[model samples]
Target: MKLKSFAIFGTFLCTSRVTLAKSAVLDQTSLIYEFPNNTWVENIAARNNGELLLSIVGTPQLFTIDPSAPSPRQPVLIHEFTDSLDVFGIAEYQTDRFAVLTGNFSFETGDLGLGSWAVWSVDLNGVKISIVNEEPTLSSTPKVAKIADIPPAQILDGLSLLSQKQQTLLIGDLSAGVIYRLDIESGDVATVLNETFTAAVPIPHFAPSGVGGLHVRNGELFFSNVGQQKLFKVPIDEDGTPSGPVTVVASGLSTLDGYDDFTFDCAGNIFVTTGGGNSIEMICRW
Candidate 1:
């Protein structure tokens, strides 16, 4: 139960040094998952076979956990949502493509919803070839391709895979806390990072709703601000284009709710997940 010891709201000010915890240091082989129907799992991706990808919220479906397969599988729904659908972000782009962001609007949208905001691709047999921007009504067959239409954007709750010398594709804009960049083979989109990280430390307010998931360790690119509990380390510029400023490491970690996504390990350690206090929080490098 270490997520800095759960429940906190010390104002949420903003930057200061940081230190206020009750729990944080877990390593049960460092794996935890509980965001199936318990709702609010937002986004998480890593499936070049490393397996562990999810995006859950009020059902629709798309969850997989193959911690090596020997026995950690019971979380496979893949992608299933019909009526007024919503599948905010999921990644695994290349070698057949898999990057989604279906929207009907929420984070803001009026009448009947269905406010689409797409950037697609699908072919692990799900077929839907190159669908970009708009146009997608559950392909699964025609192979789908090149369709553009964006704006009225609501949620694209995080997706990261930028650094293979900048293959570019990093999106997470939990309603304006912004961070966009896309080029998954040239669908073209921009806006690297925005702002919204309050939690100063016992006074600031909003902050922790964004700066969502976008893990890219080793070449650097990790984000979190779940309302300013803060955690950034962006640095990728050999042409990967993200040149300068951003290196907070970690901060007070306010209230720790369904804190969205994160991943990293190859000797740096950091694995976060807490649909607002369900579990999974392991940070290292002391």
Candidate 2:
């Protein structure tokens, strides 16, 4: 019995060492572009051409900028939703076709404007418009269209393409602590996932807002719970329906403040943005 106990202790030590060694660290950093105060950049998506599409929440606007550009890179305005006050999330659904979330939200009050949440799309392959401050130079003008209004969604903070062929979008609701799947073609919305893992802890300053980062990859739906300070995944079908139980991928992340939006690289490494912590962390699978 003593020898068995020692073997267990040895295995525990080995496991702990491996876990600690596998952690990722920021070895180098570089600034690409910085927006002005109150810009409230919420979400960003990569264009097929290697440019980045930014969704600004402080203002109802979408902008695109070339990351490869030199210092002082300027983000050209793509579209400004005068009807809405803010834009939340952006995701590329097709080639140069992106889906966007917009609504009237008050930063000061931290309250969403009811009945104002809607989904919109922008096609960068549309008409050409003159460059900003550079006359005679034309850039592709985005064709903007309102897809549907989500009257039931209190705060859809994250948007992702569930399936390109099905024309379905997976929206994360921070306030509701649920995931809603929206059919882009039929304008139909349905609740797909909701459980304790997505629930937010109540705080004094603001109401409980739950899930943040959301993405679909390898037949799995991955998300981050800001209020819970954890990352979770659920096996999902092509239609965004849950096929397996929710599982915690990472937890005990109180030090990171909260996990907001994230993206998976080609190597399956998850790059998560720490919302209040003001840092980005890369989580390795191994």
Best by lDDT: 2
TM-score of each prediction: 0.28, 0.85
| Local accuracy of candidate 2 as per-residue lDDT tens digits, 156-185 | 899999989889999998888889899998
* Model 2 pairs in collision: none
Clashes of 1: 23
Lowest summed lDDT across 10 adjacent residues in model 2 is found at 1-10
Predicted model with the maximum TM-score: 2
lDDT of 1 by residue, 196-271 (tens): 3412222122222556666666667777756555567767654334677677776544464545566655555665
Compared to the true structure, candidate 1 yields what TM-score? Answer: 0.28
Candidate 1 ranges beyond 4 A from true positions: 1-17, 23-37, 41-86, 89-100, 103-157, 160-212, 215-220, 223-234, 238-286
